[model samples]
Target: MALQDRPNEKPEASPADLVSSLAEASLALARAASEGEAYAALDMAAHRLAALSSGRVSICELGMSPNGRALILWQSSRGGLSIGEDSLFAEWYTRASRMGGEMTPARGHIWYGLLSADTLNDETGIRVAIFLKFDEMKEELAAHAYGLADIAAAVALRIRKQKAAALERRRFDGMYETTRAWLELGADIVWEASPEGILRCRRILNRRGDISRLVDGMDLRSLRIGGGGQSLLDFLEQQGSVRHMRAHLPEDAQGRMSTGETLYVSATARRSPDEDAPYIGTFTAIGRDAPSDGTRETATMLLQMRGARIREEQHRREAEAMLQGLRLLLSQDSSREKMSRLVGLVGECIGSSDACVAEKGLDGKVRILVPQQKSPGPGAAAALDFIAAGAPRGVVGVYDIDAAEGRNIADAFGLEGCQVAALALPLRGDAAFLVCVTRRAEGFAPADLDFADRFALLLRQALLLREEQSHLAQTAKMAALGQMSASIAHELRQPLNTISLAVQNLEFLLESLDFDREAAAKKTKRVLAQVERASDVIDRMRRFGRKSVGEHASLVLRNVIENVEAIMHHVLLRAGVRLEVEISPDVTAYADQLQLEQVIGNLLQNAVDAISGIGAKHERAEGLIKITASPSPDEKGMTVLRVEDSGPGFRPEIAERVLEPFFTTKSAEHGTGLGLAICDAIIRESGGRIEIGNHAAGGFVQIVLPRQPA
Candidate 1:
């Protein structure tokens, strides 16, 4: 995938021919004792082909350009004629195919085509050609080639083995040696499985890879993950491996495994292959506060020297360069803030003043459209409008400014200007809309287009994360504030109730000494109840604010809601609000009890506030508040709780902002503005959501809670 190494453009050799050639060559090298032996065998093989061709056949070398054709080099056994090197194989075939006689091999079994002319040097004025043809007996020549290949393979294997032996001798000093030894000791990679049988790895080895005592011949580089004899039995079972599954013989039952679809996983579970335990070296990977901090610091001090510092700086530069390369990878970035920074740079990256994006609409049209650019040329402007008007393939695609002609600019495309070129990039698949890169003067370059396309992808994915992070931060803050406010409210209730009661007692103390002690005691009890009610209100708020989660179970939701109402009845009465409860029978849901309680309390409190804010304006028509709960008909398993107050209805515009944290119509003293937001979060966590708006009764806020299957 390097820029220069574009595999897409690389012409693939015929699979049959490639396999045949590689197999034959591998066999030869494997059989040879050394490189010299392999070369000698190749020369002898080439000589045999020459004798078989009657000295007319040739071959091609790999990666030799003008090297576009099949590469098969030649070795003449006997011929007065010679072929020039400048001729390519494709040209030879083309010419050969056109010729009257077909390509026929001579006396040998080897089958090969002539290397033909590809170029004529302009300066030298020299033309290259291959006039050779396949002789009658080609099979003999093939046999000769195959024989040489076999010898070559032997030579290659011997040399490779010798080198590997030298390196394998040092295995005792390295982890690989440790792994190798363990595998030899009849070990299997150990892993732990969940009760559900999901196996997470504790180690990997023994099940696959080279377990043979002959260390010199093993493939060390491929000894891990897909290779290195890494046998993923389960991974293979789940995700079929095209490599070894079909290639290896005898279908090693010992290597039976499974795989994961999205994440490639090893299938076989670890077992005691023998009585002995698997040997694992006991060396700890130190954490940040390791006891060897002193030595580490001393090492760090040493690292600060010129050699280490220079290396560190070099590494830092490399990382910075990589960041620059990935500057447009807004999607891969984990942070929305980082994504936002990338967003700011997006315009500059695309050479546009303003660049906003739109996502694909559900109707397969373009919506949520964004135009990025302050003032673009007519083309850019038209481009933006065209895409904005028409649907795009996805969140991102090519938007030719030429398409938008003779259209009213500003009125049509939200805002428009001179448009030169524009490109639309869809974010997050085609889920949303396209980002229009409206540029002025210059059109987008190829690199610019490619960059914008990828950037748009990254940007879209990042947006979702950004949105989630933003929501979490807001939720956490609101939860904290809600708890504090609730606690403070609870603490103040008793004192207020005490003061109210003392005033009542004083008012009566001035009366007759026997001023109906029984009635007086009842009045004092009511005052204490109100104080307790205040304490209850505080407790409810604290419940709403608490970070701890309650155990979940299916419960009769009606009871939970009734309990909440009972707890807050005093507070509701003090505000002069009438509470109404309407819950259908047989209503049940799986949810955390305390959390549901908090959810119900928040809704009730919101109703009281809305009523108080509106009802206080006039003494009359202070309406009733209704709370209802029932199973959702459309959703197979869901419960809906609706709390409605009969006060002035909510304005449609504020409805959307109602659930946002720190958004309240009332002054700071009366409300923390965290109530609805916390309610939304708590509900969502319990698998639900809350909505605010005008009710049929007068005003309403609906809370939707998800119910787990009963």
Candidate 2:
């Protein structure tokens, strides 16, 4: 209380004057009307204390939050003390009352002390902090910092009062003016309710409407807003409160102009601890004219989704119809009637009328195809001939009757007043087919033309198929003839060679002039046997040539193998390749005997050739060709025949493709590539599978056939 005791004090300041100034500042803070005035009063008191201490000091008034944390609300400093920059000073201010004082060495040694202990625990209370350089200030100023608690309490009280007043002001402004403004903007109502569906208040905000007649303090269910299973009040109870609840209001007994329009509402509620504190909430409503951004976005997305679904359904229908039409067209037999029906179906599917087909006659003229016998008129015939003669390759040419080149056809067909589109397609076997559609409002689209081209392709493929079948039949006849010729030559050459050998023996005996009678008889007998063998070979050849196609029966597979060996044994022996046969007598197959014989003969010949070639290349003494027929492994009612040779196998890359038609590893002269191809066709047609692969030692060809049921 005396200036002489403070070493850091100004020499002129008296203790009594300082005390008087402090009292004035405290009185002003207690009577302060606003936060700014209260802060000014506290700052004045802090400055008075600083003057008495004769040392630079900074004062910070901190507020306790509801959570009991302190925040700086006001700061006053003297002589550039820079207290706020120090984080240590901030920590001291927050817990200053409890900490009492602290010392910081950062930047410089500074002393920090709490000013108010009485208001430290109050949420709205003020706590003050004092900062000074410890080395520059005397220790007596520490006492002044500790004695400022009463002044801080007065400042805290004034601030709490001002905060209450400001809160009340905001509430008052929001309640009346905010609701009224929304009403002017066409809001239907603003309301308040309890948690138990009891309506506490309702204000019709719209001025020109009679909605004010809506009774307040009525149950919310009286409005009868149909939503989900739960009432609006129950929904609010579960959700705390929901915003933008869309609901429709029904007609009520009170004659208050109910428009029954959908209203968008927002609401909020709070629960309290006290028994008297019931749930309270307010809700504001707007009419249908205005929608939130979320609602608009959702509607737009739904519209786009609906449009995409429609397009997807349309494409699916079109694809299904196209598939059905193709199936119908393919089911018809390959004849002129099939083509006619196909054109009619196409005309129906493509939305055309008066469709027709034209074919090129053998007389070098294009004739229109119809159900009845009718040729094109002279003019149209001439036009068709001109177009067919000059038709470009690979293009389905389009013609419109109105064009100069199409006028002759237009006049001949009497299409002057009618619109006509014509497509001319070139077919196989020097044929031209014409299709026409009449009475169309527009020209054919690219989709229509593409469809027409594909339909024409279908006909072309059918024609090509017929031609291929005929050619294959002819080729098969020639192949049979060639095989018969080879067998005959192979069989007769051995006997002929034997006969010549017998003649040479006879000549040697005669030249030596010591011929034995037994030796001549044996030579003469061998020659007659050779001649009989030649005749038998000729007779077999004749029988094979006359064999009927499709003549099939259950035959012993073992017997077929024996016959093939008999026919090929001489050739195989001549090639120096030993033939080995392993077949069970019970193995039998249902197949054409002649075809089966040819297949077996071809396989035997191929094996012989392969072994002979390998023998020629490297005189392999192990030239073994094995033919085996037995029941197929793991397959019921089936028989497997394999022809394996001790010759070089096919290259690894060519193994799988060796069974393909015309795929052969032999030289061109030794094989026409059709031998195995024809054999494969025959075996497959007889209900069998042919597999060819190489074993470790040599190549093997296996054929599995369904066995004949006894």
Candidate 1 to truth, TM? 0.29
| lDDT of each residue in 417-488, candidate 2, tens digit only | 234445555554546555555556575655666665655655555445434533453465456457446556
Q: In candidate 1, what are the lDDT values of residues 574-636, reduced to their tens digit?
A: 778888788866777776686677666766666676666632343336658888888876445
Name the best candidate (by TM-score). 2
Model 2: residue 618 alpha-carbon error in angstroms: 6.3
What are the per-model C-alpha RMSD values against the true structure?
Answer: 36.7, 39.6
Give TM per candidate: 0.29, 0.33
Candidate 2 lDDT (Cα, whole model)? 0.58
Q: How does residue 283 of candidate 2 score in lDDT?
A: 34
lDDT of each: 0.46, 0.58
- Score residue 432 of candidate 2 by CA lDDT: 53
